[model samples]
Target chain A: AQTVTQSQPEMSVQEAETVTLSCTYDTSESDYYLFWYKQPPSRQMILVIRQEAYKQQNATENRFSVNFQKAAKSFSLKISDSQLGDAAMYFCAYPSITQGGSEKLVFGKGTKLTVNP
Target chain B: GAGVSQSPSNKVTEKGKDVELRCDPISGHTALYWYRQSLGQGLEFLIYFQGNSAPDKSGLPSDRFSAERTGGSVSTLTIQRTQQEDSAVYLCASSLGVLGEETQYFGPGTRLLVL
Candidate 1:
């Protein structure tokens, strides 16, 4: 079974600083995709960034970036120059293929981020 | 273009009553999915529809939970005999259904509270 794990239940960072949310996963499939989603108080799941397993280059989207280590099976999210708006729940997800051949996102418990000014 | 949208942004119901949640995916999206977020379970996939056919109902918690998508655009999830444990934020998402391009756009979600 493929499983995603976010060990940190909560994390805090000072505004304008950098914070890295940890995520690890175990999957037997050689080809897959990993994603980081942000859920604010509005309850909307917004896609922050995504990384393909086949790619060696890390994915970066403006202030958001990922440190993906395929051999270690670790994928962590880094928020640079974090702002008050960056405070939200961060979830690491792995799209795993089921036995029936459909894909479903397996998500971690999530890390609640607090950006303190 | 509008993103995925869900009706009844918030619903309050008593236990044992049936509730229906609706989702309107992005126009032209062939794949739709339903997910649940609760305090205990965090987030879980309930079901997904590929152009009105659901090949993956494996994530549904029980028989009480069911979903259907018609015309490849609108989808509805019905929970029979709601339980307090069923209280959670239900989210809907849509994708192009193209292989290797799995980015999904999500709705704001419907917060369901069962009393």
Candidate 2:
């Protein structure tokens, strides 16, 4: 079984500042995918970034990036130049990718992020 | 191109009653997924459908929960004898195919309340 953990239940950051959300997972599989999803007030989940287990280099998407430490099973999200729009519930997830394509994502309890003006 | 969409954006039913939620995936998408999000909690996988493959119901919490996809396009999640604890937002997502790195686009979700 695979599980993801987000230690922080809630977080807040001032506008223009940077924030980091921590995530850790337990997986016996050597290959997989990790993702950070953002659910805004509209409740539509938006993918923030993704990291491949085999990639030693972390993933970065503009102001959003991940600090992926495979050895530690740690994948954290860093938000730079935080804006009010960034306020949302962020979730860390690991999806099981089977050869048959019958895969499901395991998600951690979310962290509610508040961006202060 | 439209993204995934779920019908009956909000559903209210009494305990012990049955409820059905529908999801319409993006055209040409061969993979569909169902997930439940409790209040202030993260998503819990429910079921998955891909092409002609057998659906994965491993994540279903109980026998009362079941899901079916028609023609690999639209899916329905049915809950028999609903419980108040079943109250949550039911989300639907779809992907182009089963590629390991394909992104799953999500819908706004159907808010189900079992009173």
Candidate 3:
């Protein structure tokens, strides 16, 4: 079974500052997908960014980026120019691709990010 | 709707009672998924459905849980003889296809409370 871990339960960043949330996972599969999802008070899970294990180049989406280290089993999310709108519960996910061409995601305990004004 | 939707937004039921949660996916999506999120915890996969194919129940925690997708556009997760431990937010997601790299769009989720 694959497991994802988010060591930080909560994190805070001042407005205009930057913050990084850490995540790690254990998987024997060489090819898979990693994603970072943001859930706000609205309880909607939004995709923040994603990284493919076969790609060494990190994935970036405007202010949101990811540092993916496949060898170390680490995938961290970096949020730049943090704003109050960025405050949310961030989760790291790994989806297992099965032989039948169907798969499901396995998520880590989330890290609540607070953006302070 | 432009995105996935679930209802009732909040449901409270007594232990041993049966509960059914619904999910409506975006039009044209070929794959749908169900997940359970406990308080202050991450999302756990429950089931997966793809275009008239057999559903995946591998992630279901117990026999009490079952889900089905109708017409491949809407899904319902039913918990028979629900238990207190079943309290959690049930989420639904849909993607254009069942490919591993496809991006999934999520619903707001249904908050289920089994008392």
TM-score of each: 0.96, 0.94, 0.95
Residue-level lDDT tens digits of model 2 in B45-73: 88888887898777789999999998878
Q: Interface Cα RMSD per model, in Å?
A: 2.0, 3.1, 2.6
Note the residue pairs that clash in candidate 1: none
Candidate 3: which pairs clash? none
- Residue-by-residue lDDT tens digits, candidate 2, A14-108: 99999999999999989888999999988899999989999999999999999999989999999999999999999999986433446877789
**Candidate 2 pairs with clashing backbones:** none
Off by over 4 Å in 3: A97-101
| By TM-score: ranked, best first | 1, 3, 2
Which scores better on DockQ, 1 or 2?
Answer: 1
Cα lDDT of model 3 by residue, A48-85, tens digit: 99898899899999999999999999999999999999
Which docking class does model 1 fall in? Answer: medium
List per-model TM-scores for chain B: 0.93, 0.96, 0.95
Q: DockQ for every model, please.
A: 0.59, 0.57, 0.63
What CA RMSD would you report for each candidate? 1.3, 1.9, 1.7
Q: After superposition, how far is residue B79 of candidate 2 from its true place, in Å?
A: 1.3
